[model samples]
Target: MKEVKVEKLLINYKTLEEFKRFKEYGHQELSMLEDLQSNIVENDSESPFYGVYYGGSLIARMSLYKVDKKYDQYFEPQHDYLELWKLEVLPHYRGKGYGKSLVDYAKGYNLPIKTNPRVNSHGFWERMKFQKATYEMERDFGQNPLIWLPEGISERNTQ
Candidate 1:
């Protein structure tokens, strides 16, 4: 298997245009476009989006956000954690390890990770050793969250 490099996507027209190939393009992307149009965001600025490119085209992508411990509700130690979202590999790229590469990149931070996996993706998260987080009606609302714990960390017992 080839090594995949997950790169921080730049906030620019080219990156945004590349994003249109992704299935999850929606409000978040549109907001970025709006920001660009209004000069609210500078070209080549840092973005939360990261992705793997194959032959110079984005084939997989995910967004990772670091949540402050003050708002953390998923870890036993109440420490800062990464909230991962929109992990998607293009249909042609599925089963090729690009998705795993992105997840592994996030895990490299060694911080606990929380993600609301898309429907039917539970198996993939499970394979990555993430476990279902105890659901809190008030904290979780309608989303089912899964979490990955690094060494010396554990999921908060919401029970």
Candidate 2:
């Protein structure tokens, strides 16, 4: 596989159109368009989303948002971490390591990472060394949380 260049997608017709390929395209996507047009965002704004393109086509992508330390409830040292979501690889590109590459890109931060494994994707998350956060009735209600910790950081286990 050729090198996949990961870039912060800009809000524009091309990008919007590219997103339509995603099943989860919805309000959040529209909001980005709206924000861009309304000048709420810079023309070339740096979005939290990062994606890898294969010769002008977006084959894999993921979003990693930084959560403030004040809201840090998952890690032991109580530091800021990334909330990873919307990690999707184009159906045609499945099994090509693109998804894992996107994940590996996120891990480049070496920060505590949290993600909700899509149904049946538990094995992938596990293979990536992400663990289910010990059930927290209040914090993790209705969600299966998977987390990856860098060295020197630990999960705040629930008793």
State which candidate has the highest TM-score. Answer: 1
- Overlapping backbone residue pairs in candidate 2 total 0
- Identify the candidate with maximal lDDT: 1
Task: List candidate 1 segments past 4 Å from native.
Answer: 24-40, 135-139
Tens digits of per-residue lDDT for model 2, 10-88: 7566766666666454425323333334432544776776778887887677777888878888888898889888787
Question: Candidate 1 has what TM-score?
Answer: 0.87
The global Cα lDDT (0 to 1) of model 2 is 0.75
Model 1 agreement with the true structure over 11-54: per-residue lDDT tens digits: 77777777766635443522333433343276666678888999
RMSD in angstroms, all models? 3.2, 3.5
